[model samples]
Target: MRKGLFFLCLVLYAFSVTLTVFVQHIGIQDRLLKIVCTLGILLSFFAVLAMLFLAFSLKGGVESLEQKENPAEKIPSKEKYLEFAARSGLSRRETEIGWLVLNGLSNIQLAETLYISLATVKKHLTHIYEKTETSGRKEFAEKVMAFGF
Candidate 1:
C-alpha cells in the first residue's frame, strides 16, 4: 500500500514537472485556466513531497524497530523508567502510559490501569510513541529497556 502510494505520487510528480514546462510554452491566454493548471501542478508536486517525507520517516522508524529488538534486554524499573521519560520530555500522562506499555501491558490493560477509555489509552500511546521517537509498542518497549540498561 505504501509502495503503491509512493509510486502514484512519483508518477504525478513527474507528470506535473513535465506539464509545467509544456504549459508555460503553449501560451494559453485564458487567465483562469492558466491559474488552475498552475495550481494543479503545484499541488501535485506538494503531494509528492509529502509522500516522500512519510516514506523516509517510516523507513527510519522500521530501522529503529529492528535495531532496538533484543530479547536479552531487560525491562526498566519504575523510578528509572519515570526518570528516563522525564528526560525524554514526555507529558505526565504520556510517561504513565509509557511506563505501563514498557511493562508489557496490553492496550485494554493500560486503559483499565489508568482509568481511561480505550480511545484515551490509544491517544496517550500515540503521544508517547511520538515523544519517545518510537513507531509502535514493541519498539517503544525495547527502547525503554535499552535506555535503562
Candidate 2:
C-alpha cells in the first residue's frame, strides 16, 4: 500500500510536469498557463506530502506488529527480577540498578530515577555485572531472565 501510494504520487507529478510543458509549447495565453502550472505544482506538492505521511505511518504499524509478535521482549515482573538480583549477591544499590537495567533503562535514566550521579549509576552497574557474572546489560538481562525466578 505504501509503495503504491509512492508510485501514484510520482506518476501524478510526472503527468503534471508533462502537461505544463505541453501547455507552454502550445502557446496558451499567459494567464491560463500560469494558473494551470500553479495548480499542477500545488497538486504535486500535496500528493508527495500525502505519500510521505502514509509511508511513515505504515512503517510504524509494521514495527508495532513486530512488537506484538514478540512477547518475551516485555519487561519481566519486578519481584522476579529483584529475587534473582538478591540471589546473585548484589548490594542494595546494585540490585536496584540491575532491575532498572533489566527494564531497559539507560544509565542516564537510572541516575535520574535513583537521584544519583551518572558515575554512581555506572559504579553500581559494574558491581551488578560482576555479581551476576555478566558483562553488559544484554547479558545481564538474559541471565536474569533465565533464572526463572
Candidate 3:
C-alpha cells in the first residue's frame, strides 16, 4: 500500500512537471505560465505531504508491532482518563450534556429527553462547552471521543 501511494505521488509530480514544461514551450501568453507554476508547486507540495504520511504510517505499524511484543509497557489504566477529565474541571452535569450532545441532540431534543426546559438545556450546554474549553459542538464531540467516553 505504501509503495502504491508513493508511486501515485511520483506520477502526479511527473505530470505536473510535464504540464509546466508544455506550457513554457507552447508560448501561450495569457497568464499560462503562472497557472502552470501554481499547479507544479501544489503538486510538489502534495508529493512531500504524501511522503510524510507514508513515513508516519510505517512508523505507526512498527510501534504497534513493538506494543504486541511488550504489551506491559502500555500507559496507565482507563480510569486515569476519567480522573484526568475530572481534574480538568468538567462537572458531572457537563459530562452528561456532552454525552447527549454527542448523541445528536439539539437543545430542544435534549430538554425533551431529560425532562428539562429548552432554556435550561442550552444553559447546561453553554457551561459544558465553557468548562471543556470547546467552542462548538463538533469540538466538544472530538474531546469526548478523545477521552473515549
Candidate 4:
C-alpha cells in the first residue's frame, strides 16, 4: 500500500511537471495565460517537492512493515537462496510455494493460501523437488532451511 502511494505521488509529480511545462510553452504569446501558467508551474513544482518529501518520510515505515511481514533476516541467507533457486530454474511461483512448504504448510493449507487446487500444489511440489534435486518434501524443506529462507 505504501509503495502504491509512493508510485501515485511520483506519477502525479511527473504529470504535474509535464502539464506545467506544456502550458508554459503554449502561453508564450498570451500575457494572461503566461501569468496563470507561471503560477501553475510554481505550484506544481512545490507540490511535487512536497510529495517527494512525504514519500521519503513514508519509506522507513514501509521498509519496517516489509521486514515485519517477511523477516528475511530471521529466515537466513535469503540472497543465497534466491541465487540457488534461480540457478535451479525454479519459477517464481515455485519458489513461493517452496517457502510455504519450508514453513511446514500442508497441501490443503498451501492450496488455500495460493488459491490453487491441492493437485496443483502437489504438482508444483513435484517440480520443485525435481528442480532442486530433492526426492521429497522433507528433503526440499531441509535444503531450503539449510539456506535459511
Candidate 5:
C-alpha cells in the first residue's frame, strides 16, 4: 500500500510538471492555462497529502507490532537474577547456570554457551536445585519468582 501510494504521487508530480511545461510552450489561452495549472496543482497537493498519510499510518502500525512481539519490557533484568543467586547462597558457577536456566536456556544450550559438557550442565543444575531446595526447572522458576527474584 505504501509503495503504491508513493508511485501514485511520483506519477502525479511528473504529470503536473509535464502539463505545466506543455501548457506554457503551446501558446494556450491564458484563462485555459490558469485553469489547467490550478487543477494540476490541486491533484499534486492531494497526492502528496495521501502519501504522507500512508507513510505515517504504516510507521505507526509497524511500531505497534514491534511492541506486541517483544514484551521484554515486563521481564526482570539479569542483575536481579544475579542478586537472587547471591541471596540464595549460590556459588559463582551455580549462579551462572541459574541465570541461564531462568532465562529459558535448555541444558544442551547452556552446555554450548558455557563451553561445558552436557553432564557438567546437568551437574550444575542439580546443585542449583539442591541449593534452592527445588525439585526441577518448574519449581526453581516458581521459587525464584515467589522470592521476588
Candidate 6:
C-alpha cells in the first residue's frame, strides 16, 4: 500500500512537471504559474531525497529487527560447535557443514571451504537437518540457540 502511494505520487509529479513545461511554453507569464512551476521543479529534488530517506530508514529498521531476533554478538568456538554437533548426532561431514552454517556461511562458501560441490553441500545440509530434527536453516539456528549454544 505504501509502495502504491509512492508510485502514485511519482506519476502525479511527472504529470505536474509536464504541465509546468507546457504552460511555460505557451507563454502564460502569470506570476502564480511561475511560482508553481519553480516549486514543481524543486519538488523533483525533494522526491529523490524523500526516496533516499525511506530506503535507508527502512533498511535500518529491518537490521534492528534482525539484531533483535539473533543478537549473537560473539559466535561460540569451534570446539563448542563440535560439541553441539556431536550432541545433535551430526556425522563428520555434516558437522563440518553445520559448523559453517552456524558461522553464517552461504552454500557456495561452504562448498568452497570444504572443497565440495554445491550438490554435496546441499546433501550434507539435508543430513544435518535430519539429525538436528529441524526442517530448515532458520529452525536449525533456533534449535542450536535453544540448545544453549
Number of the top candidate by TM-score?
2
Q: What residue runs in model 3 are displaced by over 4 Å at the alpha carbon?
A: 1-85
What's the lDDT for candidate 1? Answer: 0.81
Highest lDDT model number: 5
Candidate 2 Cα misplacement greater than 4 A, ranges: 1-77
Residue 142 miss distance in model 3 (angstroms): 1.3
Separately for all candidates shown, the number of backbone clashes (residues 3 or more apart, or on different chains) is 0, 0, 0, 1, 0, 0
> For residues 73-94, what per-residue lDDT tens digits would candidate 3 score against the true structure?
2222336435645866867766
Error of 3 at 52 (Å): 51
Pairs with backbone N, CA or C atoms under 3 Å apart (clashes), candidate 3: none
In model 5, residue pairs whose N, Cα or C atoms come closer than 3 Å (at least 3 residues apart or on different chains), thus clashing, are: none
Tell me the whole-model lDDT of each prediction, alpha carbons only. 0.81, 0.80, 0.72, 0.76, 0.81, 0.78
Report the Cα RMSD per candidate: 11.2, 7.2, 11.6, 11.3, 10.4, 7.2
Off by over 4 Å in 4: 1-75, 146-149
Error of 4 at 92 (Å): 1.0
* Weakest ten-residue segment in model 3 by summed lDDT: 69-78
Candidate 2 lDDT, 1-149, residue by residue in tens:
77787788878978887887787778788897789887887887887788788888888998998766443465577777777877899888787777777666799999899999999898888888888888998888778778854
Give the Å shift of residue 55 in candidate 6: 14
RMSD of 4: 11.3
Please say which candidate is ahead in TM-score: 3 or 5: 5
Estimated TM-score per prediction? 0.49, 0.54, 0.41, 0.46, 0.49, 0.50
lDDT of 6 at 3: 61
lDDT of 1 by residue, 47-142 (tens): 778787879977998999899765434676787788889988999888878877766679999888878899999988888888889999888877
Global CA lDDT computed for model 6? 0.78
